[model samples]
Target: MAVELIILGVLALTAASLWIPYIVGVNTAPDGSIPADAPDGFIIPPDPNVHRPWVRRAYRAHLNLLEQSVPFAILVLLVDRVDGFSALTLWASIAFLILRIAHAVGYITGTARFPGRPLIFTGGWICCLLMAWAFFAA
Candidate 1:
């Protein structure tokens, strides 16, 4: 299999599993800082201030991966469907995977202070943009 295909698979699985940490955080928080529901179908988002720190950060990390995965997967599929294999796309795919991991870790651990986390996320975004361009450049 091509590296891009393999990376795509990894990205999908990673995004799917990213929810595990947040769920664990919710279940483990003894104080019940995480709400079970919104009551009116308002669908409350994760609040960094309201939810437990770990739960909030973990939830955001999971969402961030999910948000990025769609476009990343689409670009990968497009490139693969066209048989567009190139070193640039390959590297971008690999970079995306790495950046996602780093971003998730940094977010969950709060290690990526200030611009660090955003920079890592932007790197993943750039990787997707590169893959999108690969569709044309190929």
Candidate 2:
């Protein structure tokens, strides 16, 4: 259970660190000023057209991680508390972290045309499902 918690912490940190690319891509204005066209608000919309390909990919990867993280966290915590850490749950958690890392790298590197990114993403989803199944199997 402690190891599982550590893995969850690492995954959460990975998700948080994805903001670095997004901030680098969008926060640096040419004149170091907010775009004049930006509406006055705490949250300014970034122009997607202005972002480089890798930057766009980074942003998308971050969004994808965020989308998956919520459910992943919920399921992991529920399983951890309810069933404790079985071998199946522990391996599934590790596989999920590895697959998510591969997915992010493939997305940022524009390698999705190959079998890497899509397969990793699917594998991560399967890991999530497997984790959920562990709750019932326990």
Deviation of model 1 at 33, angstroms: 4.7
Q: Whole-model Cα lDDT per candidate?
A: 0.83, 0.77
Predicted candidate 2 versus true structure: per-residue lDDT over 42-126, tens digit per residue: 2223445455567778878998888887788888898877855688888988888888887888888887746767778888889
Give the worst 10-residue stretch by lDDT in candidate 2: 40-49
For each candidate in turn, the TM-score is: 0.87, 0.83
lDDT of 2 at 6: 80
Q: Cα deviation in Å at residue 64, candidate 2?
A: 0.7
RMSD of 2: 2.9
Which candidate has the highest lDDT of all? 1
Show where candidate 2 strays beyond 4 Å. Answer: 28-35, 39-46
